[model samples]
Target: MTAPKPRGGDILAIAAQNKVNWSGLDQTCINAIRVLTIDAVQKANSGHCGLPMAMAPVGYLLYTRFMRHNPKNPEWFGRDRFVLSAGHGSMLLYSLLYLTGYDVSLDDIKQFRQLGSKTPGHPEYGVTEGVETTTGPLGQGFGNGVGMAIAAKHLEARFERDKSGLFDHRIFGICSDGDLMEGVASEAASIAGHLGLGNIIYIYDDNHVTIDGHTELSFDEDVCKRFDAYKWHTQVVEDANDLTALSKAIEKAIKETSRPSLIRVRSIIGYGSPHKQGTSAAHSNPLGVEEVKLTKEFYGYPTEPPFFVADDVLAHFHECVERGEDLEHAWNAKFAAYSKKNPAEAAEFQAALATDLPTGWDAELPVFTPKDSLATRVSASQAEAAIGKKVWNLFGGSADLNESTFTDVKDGGDFERGHFEGRNPHFGIREHGMCAILNGIAVHGGFIPYGSSFLCFTDYARPSIRLAAMMELQVVFVFTHDSIGVGEDGPTHEPIEHLSSLRAIPHLTVIRPGDANEAVEAWRTVMTHTHGPVLLALSRQKVPTLDRTKMAPASGVRRGAYVLTESAGRPPEIILIGSGSELSLVVDAKAKLEEKGKSVRVVSMPSENIFEKQDQDYRDSVLPPGIRRRLAVEAGAPMSWYRWVGLDGEIIGMTTFGASGKYEEVMKHFGFSVDNVVERALKLLAR
Candidate 1:
């Protein structure tokens, strides 16, 4: 389809227009993005340039003509969100952000991919003002956009009244063939379609070019048909540069408010590059010196001076600032009136936006005692019920393992089609997509999102988990069946080395509660934590709660590790450390060793990461240097225990897969028993 002609019937005619907004200045602004992208990538001598050049018109139309965003206030809650899911084209987003009057400066664009520069290799969330979430990991951002759509629907249901649209912002994004090909994106798309997330509108960049070669060498499915199968409102703009067609497609999508929309834009890679357009050559590399000049000439741009933006194009894009201010000003006025009518809901909305925990949110949390012998997962469910009631904005679900993971809230209705008011979202069996979506919800603000799965299944969600840690998102990841305790499910279900591997991720706090009360405290810590993602590795098998009347209070969980019980009247000769279900073993072993006239101290070490953050004085007080005989017992790999158990200490942990049997039998077979703990402590003392 051809672009609609200007009023004077010429491509370069300077004329005003209506909603289509087709003009020579619009084309100039679009080319400005293309040229700036080429300059940034060419100057860096690194980064992808193809998609930016190919989809410059697509991106320009969204930023300037369609998307309701505030360039000056990027965090305006009422503004629509735009995700560059095809984030390797970071220069594309940078150019749009700069031209549209965001905080991104010309020098920042010049420092693309440089250390400490806002324009990093990928579009990061906090580093750039307009970037909604971190991208460049392909399908992760796709899942994130769906998550944002979910968040929007949920907030709208809870807060909006009388057709007021305070929470009616849409999630706009540009995805690619690589993104669609990723398994995570497929999973996320399936759920988004199922939930009828009408707030999402993603443009597929069908440029057919990958780093290895054209996508035909790998991807060849009918993308629009596939989305149709997923219940999406699908459309295709045969020409990427056909502005009139693309605009109409998007307008039609906005009218269809029952399904998410996907508009396939058949584009050419390196759209205007003289030598490399429509080829793999321009996908990831700089267009070289001569190709750069030729490309500028192709766009009718000056060749010598790079990163140049015409004054008219700048002025054209800056119009977003005034438009955004007007839009926000009107919304603010409506919100002020809405606040008077619905004062309680308005305050709740503001608190959620600030991520502030309400007072007494945990007032109802259970304090388990020795009489309570329950799986940590079960305790987590109980704690969630109490916190969910007061927190009000705690949203999450399990990966089709709600029955086993025990993350479901009793009264929290299922978040289904047309019922987004429910807090418990059913994520089906998509672990990776669930985590990526949780990141999206967290980054979207006004909600604390979480997802749960079996500990062994976290391997499937590792990439998203790593991204969450990288982004420092406030997401809670709950993983049950934490060890050999998975029992009859056998080695495939058990998580060996999972704890140690997860601990290796920076900014991620991994906690395995020793008992029911510690599980509650872990939830408390998770609710208060704001810096990064936290993973709770809970046990499926029952473990006895410590009698806090006789032992240290469970509040010590905030300290990461504490002396649950120490040798009576003296410094302990031997120290026993454990976490999760294994904590019970050390508690029993400490009792046995004390019977033999040995001074024994038992410490509950739930989170090594959080513990390590403590001051040296507090750390020394917990594990006094004079005592070197330490024994650490757990059902997982011993790699993470070596640091806690010094050269003279011993760690009793699994070196092999667990057997299929009862949980108790399986645990003993893996040497996670009280007898094993006692034996290891004795040997350490003898040494």
Candidate 2:
């Protein structure tokens, strides 16, 4: 394969000159990765083993030569990120992480796919030290790589000055035919290429095989041309085993510097497996005892030793430890010099790297009063603008819903080709990509990312959001047009079961603010939050700002639920509960019931997950014992309300999709009006 002409300086020439021939040590290292992968799957009696065998050379080259990483301190800020998008071949990553000494022990590899083992079915982020992000659902890690690349560029632009390369590093990934086929990767690639994120270089394991059959059966398109259309610089290495050609392709990708790079490395499936090589059997099935012995013989490995690590092979791979230590030490020296030269900027930069927000960042967050003009509470579009002015770590954008979703960071500018320092990133119409990119930014660290779109599109973004929750990423998702209040656009645009569907994801915090002050508190809770991802579902219709002087302060939102209006007497006879746009309807209905001298209570539950975390005593106090006559209301689906309202309690929620009409007409038609709320309360009391 001829080398592509480099567009950068003499760096390409230097890299090519430094490249060495495929040595005996290199082959041993590559074979080690392959054998470890083979042994892992054979021992576990599960997992895909072919892809690891095919991509061993690329893995060896990246970990030992091309990638910049410190395995000892896997969280080192300057280290390059490696994402295995084809995570079914997780043993490959596990092998590299263990060999390079990132905390995965030999025992972990021996226990692949076992319960309570670090080596699970997939590479989970926090469970393993060197695993940068979780991967299992195909294409998620592909899009995550794009997000990491975008974050790297943004930080480089924001903090780098006068050759202080404090935040300079690349994101590398190995994706599969399955990963590229997924729509999320396509969405992320379009935006990544459009924005000229040149720091990403992914190796496509073009092995022409999948779980079902050869990719030719289903996927038969010019992948290189497709990426070219996305403005990516694409290359192909016919032989994945050719170290010289693969190294040249990677060096040129680094030097291209104006677009993301994809190096399609064609490789043989199950290389060295005498019978199974290039066949579907090698894709997932373990080579039987006889076949495994023959395969080892082909590679000249010892057939008797199951998990052998030759001393030389171990030394070659562990060289990464010393190399990494030196690399970080050099960067540390430069960081010290940078700190001395720019003290204040350096201090701020350090704090950002630590993901620390100023103690006062949320101090002046907006406080809405009833006397304040009524407005759509979801219009907290100003949330980022309000907190971002003081905390620079807050940076994000929307998927072309910028004006509508209210997620724009004003004056932060658009994160485009030449102005990556801008906080706002225009994600175009790629909602799935927007969510995945936000996960990337949150995992990349130094930035608290938030992405927005209409609530109905949560279907498109659910997979990435699930991964964020699984990884416990600290991201904020701003979903606007929370309910059918997004009228005139019809049922297609409205979300009926979205609230319940999103709440289904574990470790995800869903907060639907009731009014303006609650919206303010929602954003405040997000600003200092350091746990899993949080979703703020805001409204599009006008919602009344409550009189806090007569009700519980909006700060009660943090507790997930509070008595917005308590009963006139202890142990209320009946309770009315609501959240988001329907909250005011219940508030109005409570007043109507009180006029009849019946004891009544009004509850605003913005977040069910947060409320679940509250002590049982707190929960009982809010809902209380003996108050079995409960009427809960919301504009969305009500399945999740069963736990709070009890089996005997009644819920006022939509049974069907919404209709297109004026906002007020739609609310009245759906029984979200004050009259319907009072009527539901009365009916529950009569029961």
Winning model by TM-score: 1
lDDT of each: 0.89, 0.85
Candidate 1 shows a clash count of 0
Residues 416-450 of candidate 2 have per-residue lDDT tens digits of 99899888889999899889888988888888988
Model 2: residues with Cα > 4 Å off, grouped in runs? 1-21, 373-379
Q: Record all residue pairs in model 1 with backbone atoms less than 3 Å apart, i.e. clashing.
A: none
Give me candidate 1's TM-score against the actual structure.
0.96
lDDT of 1 at 630: 89
Candidates' TM-scores? 0.96, 0.96
Candidate RMSDs in order: 4.1, 5.1
